[model samples]
Target: MKDVQTCLNAMTVDVEDFFHVSAFDKIIKPQDWDQYQPRVDGNTRRLLDIFSRHGVKSTFFVLGWVAERYPELIKEIHAQGHEIASHGYAHRRATEQDRQTFLADVRRSKNHLEDLLGEAVIGYRAPSFSIGYSNEWAFEVLAELGFSYSSSTYPVKHDLYGTPDWPRFAYQRAEQIMEIPIPTLKMMGRQIPIGGGGYFRLYPYALTHYLVNKYLDKEKQPYSFYFHPWEIDADQPRLNNASAKSRFRHYVNLQHTESKLDRLLQDFRWSTMKDVYGVNV
Candidate 1:
């Protein structure tokens, strides 16, 4: 295991509520999203407080819908010295939209975020890490619109999204866009997810801890960890009528998230993508 003390990992947050998760799309239509109670503001504030207490700054991939609803919240995130990146307008996956539609969404989100902060937003994270081999065009669009980098690929096999064959670390694409894939560890001839999200919650904390350090020692690369604001909000409203799998993935171990996060934050140095990678964004 590597000494985990000095490595500054890329800490990121997908700033969306439970209702905005892709797993609940079949049950909770986007049109009905407004009718549901909005819990993102409070949940995100709690995260900000935790980061402040730990003296850690992170990148917040803000959904355009959330930014539109809570403009001041976005301003506050920026004011607090956190990096703000686009998470697209609506939570739609790239594969779900055509090239024209995808470009529009990217432009709309980037423009909105840049307009709010009066500074260029150079980073983006696709909703649900939806950019894979089939949707490679998305990166070209991101570069064309002035985004310097994207953390929109999860290099693992999954039903929802994955580019299992993509480079598992940060690399520049043909379009001049830097791609920072979610962290994964190679073991037993396969890549296992050690990054964050449901995997972090589902696995024992000890295993996740070991895997993170192992990756650090072997690859000498800082991990890019991500989680949603809703992950730590244990008391947030639960979605009704959702499938058993979605409920299990979303609700399991919610109560344990904050404590585990505290340990991880203390164990690893954390910072925004731009700072850790020294990208001029």
Candidate 2:
């Protein structure tokens, strides 16, 4: 986010517990999701309050179910001056299901957020950046569902998600719907992704700063940086079944998060995702 603040002048916030991920999907059922409410919600509130104090606004990709149960949380986020976008109803991966079901899920989540926010909801980012080559139709679904843009594709090669062949910078897809691919720096003819989550956790801050600056100097595009509220909450309960890989990815830089964030806020200008891509209101 510091890189984004330094380079793009904005950040995107995705709200979800560590367990809601695909690796732990087998363990946590929809009925059991509420068990994590107290921890996740409180931590999220802290994040919102922190951003509020900084006077930093962002585009919050909220889960629809969370919005339904915690409408006040949604209101609180908006009240503090942030843009609201959908993260689908239940955090399902787009490629895991068929096209029609995926489309329905998009529409369901979109409508749910628009109703709660009382504003036109135009953005939709798939859970885990799940929309890829297999689910390209997901974009068509988003357009049909009245969504104006999507940040669902990460333009890199990853085991979980990314579309290396897609355009790396923000651009209009087919002249109507927009595709805001995650920020990537082209190196030696290869697109290397250094934005958000794992990159934020594993890589050193200096490298991230250099990478974002490199992109700005060369590519001249806004670099997208994303983070979850739980990331900054050092005390968030660890998912018991999280594997070694998951554990490392989740916990690597917890202690340094707050400090890093402070540096980030100071280094660059930060705005909401909408503001970066020129999304109107």
Candidate 3:
């Protein structure tokens, strides 16, 4: 194993409540989002505390809807020295909208976050890593809106979202926009996702650890890992009405995520995406 302690990786949190996840969209309408109790503030604060204990700074992609409801939470994240970036005004995927609609969604989010921080919020991640070949235009929209970089693409195959053929590392997408894909490992002539998400929860921590270390040692590049606040909240209300597959994906190994995350933090050196990728925002 490589001495991962010497290499800094990018740690990120998608700051949204469980109900905001796309898997529950069919069961939980956006209009009825208020009906569900909000657990993101507490869950995210829990992550912030964990990051603090490990002396790790992460980028938080704040959803505009959450910022609108919990302004103090957004401010608290910034106060604690984490980079604040946009997760769009709503959780709508870029693939589901037209170019104009997508533009409006991101613009509203960027403006909202900037209004909160009193500084430009130049980093963005599309909901669910939703940007792909079909919606490549989204990058132009992101650039048009003054974003410095986007960690919005995953270069692996998945039923939900993935641009398997996209660059696996940071590359410029537009004049001022850089697209940083989540880290993956090339194995058996295919890309295996080692970056965090449901895969972190699904696999044994030992396996995840090995893959991450392998990627770091072989790729010789900073790995970026992401997870949602809800992933650690095992007790968050369950939407049983949603499909079984969605529930399984959302709730699988929830009880163990926090502990696993703590271990992951202790095992790796971490910093914000801006610092790791040298993106000016």
Candidate 4:
């Protein structure tokens, strides 16, 4: 039996280019996304190579726009033994879409992904972690569309998106699908966000290690951590006109991400979400 210390945590990548980030939504339009230099293909291939070096398999929540533009990339990700899941079409937030629009977006993405892989896409994640109290009904659409799980809720409070009052770990929602709120812990009566993304990039490696170990040893729960390919591309073009806060969040520690990820992969057991959660993909 595997030791609890080495139990697998879910490692995920939100596969979108540097320019597709939600931070620049006001300054950039989806129609103009193509105008930006595309770096996702090369950046994601770098992630696949890194995971390969460590013998780690990951779940890739691919944007439909990226998949349509690079079907071969999706094929190669699957061929390399990584799980392919939808990151929604258009990268629109759930709160920004009504039920019908959200449903159509997810269905379109899933259908295109399944067609490309010849297999069911069982997992999903909302862009910008936008499935919150206002859009709780989004769960019904996810379940109806045959997604078995979603990692869309971040329980920590954020200006853009969060359901801080929601369960901090994975829980079945609407009795149809599992809603895995990004892993967090209560400290000093405040929810501390530890489940990767900007938090992973912002926090020191020792603190991240301590936090993950606390979950493993005390809570006995494997954490779910996510990152985007753009996080590691330190040399990627910068959006100079973005707001100061958005610029910092998007660009902070870009040079340190890959090294931190290397340490993370080596220090813990990681696997695809389906395998870690026991959901067949």
Candidate 1 yields a Cα-based lDDT of: 0.91
lDDT of each: 0.91, 0.78, 0.91, 0.91
Clashes by residue pair, model 3: none
lDDT of 3 at 253: 99
What's the TM-score of every candidate structure? 0.98, 0.91, 0.98, 0.97
CA deviation > 4 Å runs, candidate 4: 1-4
Lowest summed lDDT across 10 adjacent residues in model 3 is found at 1-10
- lDDT per residue for candidate 2 within 1-281, as digits (tens), equals 32433455658888776667665676777678767744557777987777777778888998877777788888888877888988888888988879888877777878887877788888888988998878677888888887888888898888788788888878888737888888888899888787777687677877777887777777767767788877787777777676777677778888777667766665666788888888753
The runs of at least 3 residues in candidate 2 whose Cα sits more than 4 Å from the true structure, single-residue gaps closed, are: 1-8
Which residue pairs overlap in candidate 1's backbone? Answer: none
- As a whole number from 0 to 100, the lDDT of residue 143 in candidate 4 is 90
Give per-residue CA lDDT, model 3, range 165-205, as digits (tens).
88998998655699999999999999998888899999999
Per-residue lDDT tens digits for candidate 4, residues 1-281, read 22356678999999999878889898989999988889999999999999999999999999999999999999999999999999999999899999999999999999999999999999999999999889889998899899999999998778889888888877787648998888987778888888899989999998898888877776777788899999999999888899999999999999999999999999899998999988753
- Residue range with the least summed lDDT across 10 consecutive positions in model 4: 1-10
For all predictions, the C-alpha RMSD in Å is: 0.9, 2.5, 1.0, 2.0
The TM-score that candidate 2 achieves is 0.91
